[model samples]
Target: MHRSSDTIGAIAAALAKAQGELLNPEKNVIATIRSPFPREESRTFRYASLASGLEIVRKSLGEHEIATVQTTAIDHATGQIQLTTLLAHASGEWISSDWPVCPITETANPHRMGAALTYARRYALFALVGIAGDDDLDAPDLLVEPSPTVQPPEDPHQNRPIPRKSNGSIHKPRQPKPVLSAEPSAVLRDQLVAEIKELNGADDLALWAHRRLPTKNTLTAEDARMVETAYQAAVGPLPGRLDDQVTPLLKTAQKRNKAHLRFVAEQPCLVCQRTPCDAHHVKFAEPRALGRKVSDEFTVPLCRDHHRQLHHHGNEIAWWGNVQIAPLEAAEKLWQETLAAPRPTFRSGVQHHPRPKADERGASSRDSG
Candidate 1:
């Protein structure tokens, strides 16, 4: 501890040594984090989870003689939750920073406010160290692993000082926060866009465009020609590559996934049993990038409104009427049940209508278009 009589040189030396050791990124203390709660629309953006942040401070900074403490207070003017972080040095000197928690509103429900404050705490501490995630160029965090309950710093703003036991540790149960997701950072988004553009060359792109143009069926020959001509006019002449003569078969994994989603959308909303649904891809297997998404086969069909709700407030436990179900796991189980059902065979008496009119059937209409 520093005394009023302590020499200035000793204090400076101690802080310099600690700062130099702490700033090195090469140390194993920092971690690369991929968020468990990525944006429902995309997974390209992520931030350090609270667990990861606490782990970093406890493990990384503690080793360097620094301890992080937080003081939570309400910004009365804005009525926003504020979390202030104090990075204390072993020498009894410290630096503190405070930021208002944006997601917590003045009129938010208590539960929501608690959750938002929890999220803000993690972010404030994580940022103080200048560490970053892969997507940080940023967004919102989880931990399934067991860990210690990180103690909060003494809240100086409170009327009374918080008491500590003789051992000098306090126990506090943290309310887990849900992510308030943001769009991908400009740098990461640009990198992804550049990667996609560089993925295919001019010739390949021209042929890909040509094949995508409607060349037959729901589309009249005249319509097909018009589309092809327009495509050429806009982008340029088609490449010398061969035309896609036969319609593509639904064998590729991508095709199979699309077909499964279509089939699921045909059914009633899995949550509310409502019609006209959107197929939401839930967690299954490992998470992948937006462009290399997991198949729609793992989706749960929900109405547009419910789908938005899930993206917003639906955690692992979703309340549908009197039932509490984990949407992803429930959807997986539903899919498993279908596998056990026997497929019915077609009888000779039933005639297959192979030739479908464009206006009557989607397949023909798609082809014609």
Candidate 2:
């Protein structure tokens, strides 16, 4: 260390000795960042904003005498924001540390760039000060816990088939394209039927698909194609597709309805009528499987805060039930109005509309591959 820095070091040591207990990172910082956008399908959450992280450090560090936190632009190209935490001692000496942090945003828009800077500053402070906070994006989705009554599968990977590598490319084995004949032969049909049976029963799933899609049951060629698609999608061909934004044919209908309901339901908090809302399905009509409330068409807008309130406090169950009753003319009117209004082109952080691609039968989807 420089001889000149010795004096500054001594001052910092003494200050830390006297006030170290006060800088509890846990007390100051929000450990778990509650995401504004939570993907139910993936069961993941987004990180907190830069402003939030910084405020914690600022508040915690202020207690140390004559302390100040400043963030300066360090690099424009790499989008690094340097944060400096400074403390000036009474002996005409000061101690400081500079933590340079990189931007997190992938895109380079001016607004987004600025936000990245703020995020960098916030993280830099956390790094330099040893603040503790859980990064929401770092964790994976929670898996379903095994039921005590049921015997767990011997191999966790038992049913998982070897993923296909493309033969077209060296990276993935090339899968033989299924013969696109008018319909498969009896043996092939039995095989496809067996595959579908292994999954969430073919009858219920097929029935669900028939109800959702414009297809006939059992006999129609279209129905057969859908069953095949559903089987292939579930088994091996489409790896990692179970977690896709667009559910495969057998799995897609309910999720599709939910997505459509959410997109069309956007407006304001139904209770307070404000933007930055959530689509809360009013289930007063009837409770369906997978916690679907009536149909997704019943989804109405509710601000995040109020939405939480409804879920947390169920004292108003009767009132909520009343909203679900048929002849919901008022709800229908609101739905029509939103549909009639111009569609919002942008929904910050969320890409792709609730509407699915045309080929996918209006099921919500994104670049799952």
Candidate 3:
């Protein structure tokens, strides 16, 4: 019965191909036979035999060969045998039996079949994009293959194995030790303290003014002592006053004037009243004059956003001109207004200038009494 079915299948496959209905039917049968079998212990041997035969045929013939097969199974209740033949195409499509079947085509490149199968196993039916033909295989595709085991590069600076010496040997370079700047010794500290105490008692403002003035880069120990004493007198007993804060402030003010002294002259941001505000010069100082340490009256402290806004609305703020206005009065007024006046609801983040409220108008009328 099996031999008769095979012959009938071959004849049917040939007829289908002659009729231009089947194309490369052999691969289609191989694909069907290679498909996973259903769980039936009785059919295990049959399934294995079919798989082996399909594999052998696939090895002997190229993947493009066409074939077909027919099977007749007896319907026990009807007591009739039904015969059907299927033409299998290389593209894995099967035609005939009871209904018409669509012919499948080779959509993927044959060379990338292994890679495609690997990717399908890993990613589960993930479709590859832009893979057309042989031309699509480039350097990127070659790199996708498994690479050989690569050894790490050797370090050139590694010490070579040498014979041991009788005594421990040292190989120090004959370079002279570099001389660092002379730091104030313990003796200098004691002298500095005494001078600071004396300067504190004498004239504090003079000491402060002296510290603000710049000294030459070639200042001696005596000059450092004098500067330290003056700085201590100005700042008093504030924590980290001498070294951390005072010295840096004085140095900055001296080197680039009070404008460059970030903390000394800077106020809280005008908009947010936040500390560490940006230094914004109302007048654009010439780049050349920046290093001269000239005291300019046109600088102000503004946060980043407000500084940008100041430049954007330069014409409005320009009314103040290059005149240096002290922030103490403005800050005092703002504080007073916040306390005594009705709190004005800000529509946005900006604070509008103070205006007379209704209560203030009433109070003024009553004060006339």
| Candidate 3 segments exceeding 4 Å error | 1-192, 200-202, 208-335, 341-344, 348-354, 357-369
TM-score for each predicted model, relative to the true structure: 0.29, 0.29, 0.17
All candidates: CA RMSD (Å):
25.7, 19.0, 32.4
Error of 3 at 175 (Å): 30
- Model 1 Cα lDDT, one tens digit per residue, 14-49: 445544554322222334445432233333434445
Q: Model 2: how far is 116 from its true place, Å?
A: 0.7
Give the true-structure RMSD of model 3.
Answer: 32.4
**Which is the better candidate, 2 or 3, if ranked by TM-score?**
2
TM-score of predicted structure 1:
0.29
What tens-digit string does per-residue lDDT give for candidate 3 at 1-369?
111332345444544344442122122221122322123222111111223333433333233354544444443322223344444545454443421111111113454543333322222101111011112223534645777988879967547554455685654446553322446344444544454455432234333234433331224556555655555454443332222111211222312334233422344554455556665543322211212432233234565645554554434223222222333334233333334655546658987655566685344323211
> Candidate 2 has which clashing residue pairs, if any?
165-172, 165-173, 166-172, 166-173, 166-174, 167-173, 167-174, 269-274, 356-363
User: Count of backbone clashes for each model?
Assistant: 4, 9, 6
Ranked by lDDT, the better of candidates 1 and 3 is 1
Q: Write the per-residue lDDT of candidate 2 for residues 102-180, one digit (tens) a residue.
A: 3322234577666655665655545545554444444353445756697676997667766655664335357654443
lDDT of each: 0.48, 0.46, 0.36
**Residue 91, candidate 2: C-alpha displacement in angstroms:** 4.8
Determine the C-alpha RMSD for candidate 1 after optimal superposition of all C-alphas.
25.7
- TM-score for candidate 3, please give it: 0.17
